[model samples]
Target: MRLIIAIVSAISRGLGVIAALCLLSAVLSVSEMVFVRYVLGHSTIWQTEFTTYAIVAATFLGAPWVLIQRGHVNVDILQLAAGPRLRIAMEVLAALFSLLFVGLLAYAGWVHYEEAWSNNWTSETVWAVPLWMPLLPMPVGTIMLALQYVAEIMRLFVEPDAEDGASRNTLFSDTAEGTRP
Candidate 1:
C-alpha cells in the first residue's frame, strides 16, 4: 500500500511536468502562429489547432498533480466550523463522490478515444489531425485522477489528520489574517 501510494504520487508529479510542457508548447505555437500570420503575411494551418489541443491536454493532465498537492482553491467555512469527526466524514464523502464521478467520466472518455482510434477519425479542418491524439489525454488524465483519489482515501484512513492541514487544526492558519494589498 505504501509503495502504491508513492508510485501514484510520483506519477502525478511527472504528469504535472508534462502538463507544464504542454502549456509551454501551446505558448510557443501561438507565438509562431502570430509571426506566420502577421509578420510573414502567410496563412496558418495547424498552429491554432495544436494550441487548442495542448491547452486541453494541460488541463486534463495536470489535475492529478493538483489533487496530490492539495493546491486547489478551498471553501472551508463549513469544514472549519465542523467537529473533527464530522470534518473527516465530510471529506470522505466528498472524495467518494468525486471518485465516482471521475470514474464514470474516465469510462466515457475511454469509449470516445476507442471510437476515434478505431474509426480513424480526423478533424474536419484541412490539417485533418487524428482525433485520438487529443482524446487520449481525457481518459489517461482522468484515470490518473481516479488513482489519486484512491491514494487520498487510503491516506485519510491511515492518517486521519493529514489532509488540508487538518493536523494543525486549521485549513488556512497562515492566512487567518486575510491577504490584502
Candidate 2:
C-alpha cells in the first residue's frame, strides 16, 4: 500500500510538471502568434492549433495532480460535522465512482484512437499533426487519474487518518449539512 501511494505521489508530481510545461507552451505559442500578427503582419497557421492542443493536454494532464493537491473546485460545507469513519467511507465511494467514469472514458478514447489510426487521420492544416498524437494522451491521463484515485482509496483503508490535511472534503454536499445518504 505504501509503495502504491508513493508511486501515485510520484506520478502526480510528474503530471504537475507536465501541466506546467503545457502552460508554458500555450504562453509561448500565443506570444508567437502575437508577434507574427503585429510585427510580421501575418498570422501563423500552427499557433492556434498548437495552443489549443497544449490547453487540452494541460487540462487533462493536470487532473491527477489537482486531485492530489485538492486544488479542484469543491464545496466543503458538510465536512465540519462528519466523523472520521464516515469520511473514509465517502472517500472510498467517491474514488470508486471516479474510477468508473474515467474507465469508461478511457475505453471510449481507445476506440476513437483506433478508428483514427485505421483511417490514417491527420489534422487538415499547415501543421498536419497526426490525430493519434493527441488522442493518445486521453487514455494515458485517464488511467493515471484512475490509478491515483485508487491509491487514495486504498490509502484510506490501509492507513486511516494518516494524513488529515490531505483530504479536501468529508462528504459530497453543496452545503454544510453534508451528504445525507
Candidate 3:
C-alpha cells in the first residue's frame, strides 16, 4: 500500500512538472506570436493554437498535483470546525465523490481520445496538429487524479497522522506534516 501511494505520488509530481513546462511553453509561444505579428510584420500560424492547447493541457495534467497539494479552492470552514472523526468522515466522503467524478471523466476522455486517434483527427488550421496530442492529457491526467484519490483515501485510514498528501513547499510527497516518507 505504501509502495503504491509512493509511486502514484511520484507520478503526480512528474505530471506537475510537465504541466508547469506546458504552461511555460504556452507563455513563450504567445510572446513569440506577438513578436512575429508585430516586430517581424508577419502572421503567426501555430503559436495561437499551441498556446491554447498548452494551457488546456496544463490545466488537465496539473489536476492530480493540485489535488495532492489541496490547491483547489474550497470552503474549508467546515473542515476547520469539525472534530477529527467528523473531519475524516467528511474528507472520505469528499474523496469518494471526487473519485467518482474523475473516474467518469477519465472514461469519457479515453473514449474521445480513442475516436480521435482512430480517425486520425487533425486541427482545421494550417498547422493541422493532431487532435490526439492534446487530447491525450485529458484521460491520462484524470486517471492519475483518480489514482491519487485512492492514495488520499488510504492516507486517511492507513496513515491518520498524515496531512492530506499535501506539501506546502514541494510539488510531491507530504514532507511538511511530520509524516514518515
Order the numbered candidates by TM-score, best leading: 3, 1, 2
**Over the full model, what C-alpha lDDT does candidate 1 score relative to the true structure?**
0.86
Clashing residue pairs in candidate 1, if any?
none
Cα lDDT of model 2 by residue, 14-75, tens digit? 98799889999999999989999999999689999989888888887888888888786666
Find the 10 residues in a row with the least total lDDT in model 3: 166-175
Cα lDDT of all candidates, in order?
0.86, 0.78, 0.86
Displacement of residue 101 (Cα, Å) in model 2 is: 0.8
lDDT of 3 by residue, 99-157 (tens): 99999999999999999999999999999998999999999999999999999887766
Write down the TM-score for model 1: 0.86
- Scanning candidate 2 in windows of ten residues, the lowest lDDT window is 172-181
- Candidate 3 clash pair list: none
TM-score of each: 0.86, 0.84, 0.87
What is the TM-score (0 to 1) of candidate 2? 0.84
Comparing 2 and 3 by TM-score, which wins?
Answer: 3
lDDT of 1 at 28: 100
Candidate 2 displacement at residue 1 in angstroms: 1.1
